[model samples]
Target chain A: MSDKTTGNTTGTDNFPQENNESVKREMFKPLSRRSFMKAGALGALMIGGTATALLPLRNFKNDTSLENFFQQHYERLTPERMERILKRIEREIKERHGVDANVQDPKPIADVQFAYALNISRCIGCRRCVHACVEENNQSRNPEIQYIRVLEMPAGTFDVEKSDHYYSHETVPAEGKYYMPVQCQQCENPSCVKACPVSATWKDKDGIVVIDYDWCIGCRYCEAACPYWARRFNFAEPNIPKEQINPDMAYLGNRIRKKGTMEKCTFCLGRTRKGLLPKCAEACPAGARQFGNLLDPESVIRHILREKRVYVLKEEMGTRPKFYYWFDT
Target chain B: MKNNYKSVQNEAVPEFIRNYGLFLFQAIRLSFRGSTAFYAWMIFLSLLSFFGLRAYCNQFVEGLITTGMTDQVSWGIYIANFTFLVGMAAAAVMLVIPAYLYKDEEMHTIVIFGELFAVAVMVMCILFVTVDLGRPGRFWHLIPGIGRFNIPVSMLSWDVVALLGYLAINAHVCGYLLYMKYLGKKPNKLLYMPFVFLSIAWAISIHTVTAFLYVGLAGRPFWNSAIVAPRFIGSAFTAGPALMIIAFQIIRMTTGYHIGDRPFRLLRQIMTISLLTTLFLLGCEVFKEFYSQSLHNSSARYLFFGLHGHYALVPWIWTAITFEIAAIIILLSGYSRKPGSFVWLNMACILATVGIWIEKGPGLIIPGFLPTPLGEIVEYIPTYNETMVCVGIWAIGALIFSWMLRLAIPILSGIFRKKNE
Candidate 1:
């Protein structure tokens, strides 16, 4: 993505001619120690002035103050500059958060065709996925980062069942209630990405819609814009118990989210990047959640898509969600 | 000489003390006998504040666990209030433009009231946002260079700048005019006109940028439409002008201070145009959603006709439509055009204002987020504390409006003459 030497071409061309003229002028001048000292002093002063002029420009390049950062906007940042920014971010994280956060530059998983499938017949509505998500991603306990919502749809009825959203205690999924777990589908064309005026949210190369927390303004536009209600806003700082916070965190995808920004599941990119399964997939006692590369013909997701009678939520909208579900018929 | 001697004797007890005593007595009597509406509102807000404070305390003590919002419904009433109030703020610009730019004499009498209303609304908007935030102290980060503003990428940057600028301009323009009127002098016309133009452009920018904030998000299918901006502006104008009409009538009836017939007619005309535009925009939105029939189309359907019988928002949508239609009919009728129909028109305006508030405020934003990102629909009903905070902030805005009017109206009407003689 970067063409580094190409950037200095204009500067390189300007330097030679200026140097030749100076050398020619030097040849005509008398050689003396005193004159040389004077020449060196003048050269130093010129260099100092040029450096001074460039200092502000350099500061402009590095200054991450809110206003200047907002002024430059998000799309304008180059990859190298972004990397430097990430390093600065890591340094700040260490300084403020007091944890040595490992900042990894994980390239977007290529040709993976990541997709999720769920067996609605097997899901017992235990809410293990919700707890798993809170632990996997450093989510605040207050508002809670509930990436997956398990709806207890009544059996033999396609209609949404009357179930309390705040269902608690040891009561198991009742006789008639069938569990439906929902999260971000990692759509082919995401509406949340399109609705962002500042391009704060976008679909990465791997088809996951991700938000740069630093760039998001807590406008909650993305939260309102999503048809699936997938996005969540941090009205306050997410409170995660220190001991429970998963130390391994993704930079832009999932970290300790600040107050006044939007967040959602990124398919557990931080874990999936390291060749591990998502926490929800790991926590499912019934083995209801399935994750695999859809592009691989031998993968479970691909097999399910090809053989099983599978359906995506809101398929008619052309959002092209990667998540799928199937019945046990 | 006998009269002078008597007057001197009367003044021997110290005139300042006597006058001060009389002022205190009048204030005490007024407090005792006047309508308890203000105190009632205060008590209600206090109760709300107490509950809200408790909720906030829990939120701080335990984190966001105090609220019902999960990852799916991260945004609730607070955000809806933010968007709604931003629209309200923009609506207030209607009075500023006509009164200052066009120099409409009839609008001039009530324009400051609009400015006062804007100030009040903006205050509430900011307050709601503050309470909604996890770290309210971080708000100062938005100050131009202090915290980073992600400008072109974030409409929030523009929102912050515009809101602060509008507040400053309103204070300066309204304050100067009031001060001049108080001193019984002509206002400095030169200073106000520049700010007036700034305010006009600022008004449009505030609402348009807020619309852009929603439309910019590409991930959300429902919010990514091109129509959101125009729709927001239309709603803002309709709601704002209607509110002004209601306020004018209330003032007229209670204080017997008539703003005259011409101004009301002009306002009615503005409201009519705004309402028509609002309806047209809404029609376009409906057509687009139905015609496309894409995955994104489901949310609109859910909002209008309840997907899978969730049906919570159905009543609000119906109420909005009914009140909007009724308001338009009344304004367009021959009876509405009659001079004595101010009372009826005011009533219609009030209803329409309430309707639009419900629609744009809570109706549009919340339903769009249902059926979580994971495809699970979670029902969201705002807690009692949320409602209370909303009421309290609204009361705070009203208090500001009342105080500003109390100070401005007395001077503007020439009722309180200067002591120059």
Candidate 2:
């Protein structure tokens, strides 16, 4: 590409030479030892100037706090270290939100794989479980981050695309509508866990997928990778009134999330691991929600799995969700 | 003389390092010296870049709520621009392949510029990715050892490896060649040839891995097609070369550099085929989505035709399609080759460049999230702050390219050779 253009420019009356000479007349000086030294000094000055201009960014350390910002990932934290971290989180929450927060790191019970089964036939589409979850999990109230989305589908159609996510009806189960509340499925093969580049989220021994809020880079790859739309990102600082603050928080569960991290339903492992029912399950007024240990052969979830014609959402996506929905036989 | 040569050989490491350092110093000095117009352009770009920094600072302090992205539409224009620039970076391989593999003499001389362009675009890609991160401060968590690096499983890790590897490769190749030129020495084939070939393969991997970043996700049906990788390659070659054509022309006109018409002709030919392939792949995708008509087709529907009256993207995509069609027709008709019809060539190149930016940027990204995974139709519009940030990133890219070209033009023209030489 060079030879021809150089030839053409030369042919066009030494225009290239004139341009070069003009540049030389203005800015191009013959390189000398002194000039080289001057350039080096100038380069150093420029570099120093840029570094000084960016010095204010150091204030960010004080904001996120150096300790909280670089805290160890959940799995790697030893019990003593975890206790210290929990105290730090409690202090930070109390300082930030002006509330006494009891932050706990609840471990999954061994040999217990928690599972949930919802009786779709009994669901009234009241959306009470959605609000109950927010109150229990300490989700942001201003932008209203809800883990559960009660999709109202029309009668006789299994098409999720046709369902209404923001449906507002006057009464219970308006006419021919049915409600299917979807949250994190706690998948055995969770796509969100795989999509995470930092390994900040993982499937626990109890089948619940949990996120290390401190460790997440907030790239939102997991949000896009999830087929169930189970993942949520804190786009803004999470807002909760001091009174509404769920002081009983778990480290990998409903602990108050900072801005720019991924959060989702941990199947209320904060409660479930302690043999307490999930907030959503406990709040379902219709007695439609069921939660139990799937490993226990005599458990309701195991019986439901064996007998009920239960359906898993987006089963074709190959995410083996433990959350089952079955209509009454 | 023989004894002096022996002494120099003994001190090869320090001698070589000093010479390389001198070469870098000289290159930096040259970048500072340019005409009034060049200074004006650089200043303009600097202002834009400073504005971008200011906006980013605000975003940093206020959180992503300053941007339009929400939980529903998580990945927005930053990701869109990242995707497009990745293609631009990969496009440098088009020049590399012709220069090395085919031994096109015309391409060989100018391939350095292409690699330089790749370096600039790759920098932009990195910055875009960084700015998009919710916790940019926690980026260290992605480091291999200190942080948990999810490799071999997450396609994102593959992307990180591919992108950084490609950046390092191109930077090394450019640095080696430029330094060789500055030293008045022949660049050893052993030193750079293997790297050049690796880069050619690595370029394709960067785009393939980027596409796989989206393709591997079964959640987004719009990107789950087998043809996405092929389409990414197809569009990248088209936009990358078209950009080179325009940039080469500007360089030739301004600096009186000898950028021959041969590379332009070669690139235009490449574009003709690649553009056609891009359209054909688009046709295939459209056919499968509309013809089969499954529940998964809602995203495609939302992209091509609005879903539930949310048609904000409809005009944008159609405009992109029109531009591509027009550019393809102009190229195919041979109007660009006719005397005094270089305007047609410029128009076609610009059309193709902007067209692919839309098709790949907003057209591809926004739609993928639309009728979002759980069938929610949430439209993502880039706010002024977001758009300003993008503009700022592009200006930064332009500034980097301009500085590198300023240094290169003098050296390539033999005006700025080694001082003693």
Candidate 3:
């Protein structure tokens, strides 16, 4: 290669002894020490750049920031830190989706634990609740995240094996079947909370299990832990359009979730914390959903528990879910 | 086997402790010294790894959507391979038990190869986990103090600790012994001896912990069983020693690092017992699922007979079972005594290794998720890119194992002999 280069420069090969010597010098010369170091440095920089380019840049930014390192668990975070994180989330949501979402940390009300009751007889299984929950929670549109799965079961038996969640029937609650909408059971002993290796998820004082998305390592332990299959994973970035983004968000609830974290039904914390029903319960056209403070004697859930023969899914597992199901008849 | 190198000023102090650069350069240089086939294998592994990395990069860019795993099957081939590799890594304990506890000399010398294999496989285990994570960058979330890892609550946390601890112990023992060999000195019995014992116990725990990661999950009835841990140990022992059997033969043929027939014969026995036990346990699981007629049997039923017309894993499970049966037959045959039956022994080892890989990986994990929590059975098939990453990690493991053997074999055989000798 050096001989060809020298010939090209001199316009003749072996035309002169000096040219041959120059060619030999060029060909036989060892790489200079400084040049070697320069090449090594360039190589290191390129490799580093390529590696850095592979990761989600936004995740890196949030995960490595000083505040992220010092961030506390949802239960441990002080009011000031909570407010700061809330504001940060609001700003991030605005930047990512062009929406002025109200990201707040809603505290569990004192002496007010929550419970839900679903009237199986009245549900038409229209699947309106599934879409409403996903939309209100700012779930991933591409992955089609839906927290609520309405299973159509044969009326005579509650055999889960015979039930199907993805049955595409053309009518309301197809004949000889009952619609059973299953979401986060919010068990008194939630397996998901127990399974989280990072303590990123936990049951709040309000009887709703919540996850700290920022703190989640996205190991999907919680997803694997859920008995109801109620959990959803963000396989990619939550691609909600600007117009579709719900401005009302909560830190542990219906906030714009990020890629890779686990999100599940929070019983619509943004609304529920404000004494309103969850979006799914409100969206139910059959009025089959029931929500109230379980501890309150006057609450309708307490009345149903007393009057009806309520059953919990997987009762043998000892999960003690706060969500109950009963026949309206 | 005698120490006869030039003495340093502080003969008590190690040469590596004094001048690290010389030891490192020499070790690295020795890794590159091998036969043409060895070099060819290395080049092939490197190229495979290169394509694997490129595929991984594409997956990173496009997200897990590049894979066929949906919510129904969140964990596909990667997690399955990770589980199998953990068992492979733990199989080093088989060597540790015979060499350290039983004080067998030939086993002692060859144990280093098993340990080297452990280090390589452990690295692959970690890589598989990293690639499987949706947010590998936020791995800091698992770091102590820096990030919150729920230690006692999550079985996964326990697995992480077990694997890292196993890696540390094996690395320390391997490094200490090899360095002592390079310097032509006796390894301090106290230095690596305690670690060898610790590693034996730690090896069992790594697989047990991994099994617990699946079994402790209340959602997957297929995994939630007392049989989970024992079955893991059973498959691991069958797979692990079977691997060492193959490695010993390869090392003998290529490097002339001959380990006698005793280790091979003993390993054959272990493999036979463990393989049969695994097959029996599989039978028990099948009967329990099919006979009892419980709702939980849905997963096991799916695994064996195909549930609801989605039998993607049907061929794989059957093939693995066939391999296991064939391995059992070969190990028990009259060829067991004949020295000329080296090929048969190697074949048995190969069958066991491949059989356990299929048995422990997709056959075990995917079914746990099938008839998913909501009674949905969405079949999972690994994509080309996902396959690329898996193959890449495997190639990296093979290369690391090759390099470790390259450096260790020469020292053990006295290729770097004393001047007087």
Highest lDDT: give the candidate number: 2
Tens digits of per-residue lDDT for model 1, A145-226: 5777777776765533244455554776777777788788888877677555456678877767787776665555556556
- The TM-score values for the models, in the order shown, are 0.64, 0.93, 0.89
**TM-score head-to-head 1 vs 3, winner:** 3
List ranges where model 1 is wrong by over 4 Å.
A1-329, B1-68, B256-258, B291-295, B371-374, B415-421
DockQ for all models, in order? 0.07, 0.45, 0.19
The C-alpha stretches of model 3 lying farther than 4 A from their native spots are: A1-72, B1-16, B416-421
C-alpha RMSD (angstroms) for model 1:
21.3
Q: Each candidate's chain B TM-score?
A: 0.86, 0.95, 0.94
lDDT of 2 at B33: 72
**Candidate 3 lDDT:** 0.80
For residues B1-421, what per-residue lDDT tens digits would candidate 2 score against the true structure? 1232243344546887656655666566567776668867987787678667767766786678889998778889999999999999999999999888987776876899999999999999999999999999898888998888899889998898899999999999988887776667788999999999999999999999999998998989998889989999999999999999999889878877776778888899999899999999999999999999887888888888899889988898899999999999999997987753469999999999999999999888888887876778877988887888888899999999999988876666656656532
Ranking by lDDT: 2, 3, 1
Steric clash pairs (candidate 2): A1-B106, A1-B260
After TM-score superposition, what is the CA distance of residue B209 in candidate 2 from its true location, in Å? 0.7
